[model samples]
Target: MLSLLLAAAPPALAHHPGADLDKMMGSEEKFFQIIDEPAAPPFELADADGKAVRLSDFSDKIVVLYFIFASCTDLCPIHSEVIADIQRKVNATPMKDRVQFLAVTTDPVRDTSEVLDAYGPAHGLDAGNWMFLTTRPGQPDGTTQKLSEAYNVRFEPLEDGQQMHGAVTHVIDRGGRFAAKFHGLRFDPLNMVLYINGLTNNVRKPAKPEPGWWDRLKVMFL
Candidate 1:
């Protein structure tokens, strides 16, 4: 519901207007393509164990949500690596307990539980706070893929058995609002971590102080 944008003057910014989050986002704000949409569409999908899991299951934590299939040899692999980089960083901090990384497969038929279970470790993703979720048995095919489309990602099946889809990392704030996104695999992963950190703390870190006259004078003298 709130859009996080950076303006020329911090105080004049709109949205959550002048909150600490605004301060923290600062120049790194460009990395987050903030959304002006409703709460993320809720869905009940199964994890690797076939147990039902919903978006609300992570209600108390910040979620880095993305989509991928194990067989793709293109952007999906790089996308997972990017998320893994951010995941490793988040896990190293206190935010680890407060953050969750979810990878929903677009190719549910080929990405079975065994494949889903092996995908994370193969991609260097830690298991502690991450899970590879998929459609459960008896569910219609492409059920979870449809969920990706709901998030504005398109999935076109190619004749080669691979999907043609754009890469995006969706950031869901603690309460399940589809708060922001990092579009494309080219964006910096650190920015993603900072955005999650801001969500975790509910405040942007204060901006760094500018150099004082005394410090400037000392620099000039030295």
Candidate 2:
């Protein structure tokens, strides 16, 4: 049975990994907005500990980025939950170290150190690979909100202390390339895991299988 399966398997094609991912996802994934930009919008924000963190800091790793505020009662929590699910799936694999998760708060003034610190663990985000970022001390309150606009997302302030915004998960490849966006909270987490796997897999060229190994195995089984 093993020999039959091996003989029946289709020949592996040598193609660019990024192009393969785009082709596969273009047909199967309706939620992805693929971007061809050379660089993602840059920002420098502070984590819960008040240490400055910039987008460039993660230039060596793939970045899974999103925007949210702790006080948002509608889509923000749902978005965080979705991201947490994706993070869990990513962390389970060897690709964990090659990826980083970042959540930028549009309401930096309200999401203080304490709020940013608790938001992750509360939503099941692993602190080892995830971070919730906000404006550093002395930065304007609307700084992050404007940055969100640059990423093609909007966070409108409402009279009720909640933000009006759409949920978009941005994928930034190493070296700051804006790769794609997974829109809304409904995209399958596994699809994202697979996408990140493609990016990481592209870093190393895979060895080709030995020629005629399938035929040799089939003859042995016969």
Candidate 3:
């Protein structure tokens, strides 16, 4: 069976924490400024089967990175449902062979192998083209805080033991660099396919890390 591997991009890239704070504070667009020069941070986490995977492993394919905990009640579920829809839509496109989806769970304590093994198929995730990952405290790539900070995700474990995070999807080119970013509850994977296809023949580099959803979410809540 064919399978996609998750990878850690590289260090030095470690997103400059809070650097986007100024930009986000200013613009109403609220998307990461699209640095377009930095590569995705390197990472190594385990797949549902307990096998190690890295962002670099998908060097020649498109990777969609998003943060979510399995027990999410609202946006996460909506985001995931959109992802599944995107997957179905992409299967009919020419970009099918070139895409891979990576869902990283911020709540590792609860999103372990057993959790993923259980969550994988029920939610329309195809282990061959899509991989679900959760990093333990000492997984050797980067810390949860580092990854969360890099991606700008602020996840707090609620009393009910559910995860709260900003809803955003990270679209990384095959070269392991940031490309387009899509936000909001609704998703359009075709936009991702078009960008990847256009970028395939050009020089790719790491762009800036996307911002956290907490600030935006707070805005919505208020």
Give the top-scoring candidate (lDDT): 2
Single out the weakest 10-residue window by summed lDDT for candidate 3.
1-10
lDDT of 1 at 57: 95
- For residues 39-89, could you state the per-residue lDDT of candidate 3 as single tens digits? 877788878777788889998987878888788878777777778777765
Per-residue lDDT of candidate 1, residues 34-94 (tens digit): 6735588788888888988888999999888999999998999999999999887777666
lDDT of 3 at 56: 93
In candidate 2, which residue pairs get closer than 3 Å at backbone N, Cα or C atoms, i.e. clash? none
* Candidate 2 structure quality by residue, lDDT tens digits, 96-158: 798999999998878989999999989999999999998998987689989999998998888
Q: Could you give the C-alpha RMSD of every candidate to the true structure, in order shown? A: 8.4, 7.6, 11.7
Off by over 4 Å in 1: 1-29, 36-38, 204-222
Clashing pairs counted in every model: 2, 0, 14
Residue pairs with backbone atoms closer than 3 Å in model 1 (clashes):
20-204, 21-204
Which portions of model 3 show Cα errors greater than 4 Å?
1-33, 136-142, 187-189, 200-222
Lowest summed lDDT over 10 consecutive residues: which window, candidate 1? 1-10
Residue 78 alpha-carbon offset, candidate 3, angstroms: 1.0
Model with the higher lDDT, candidate 2 or 3: 2
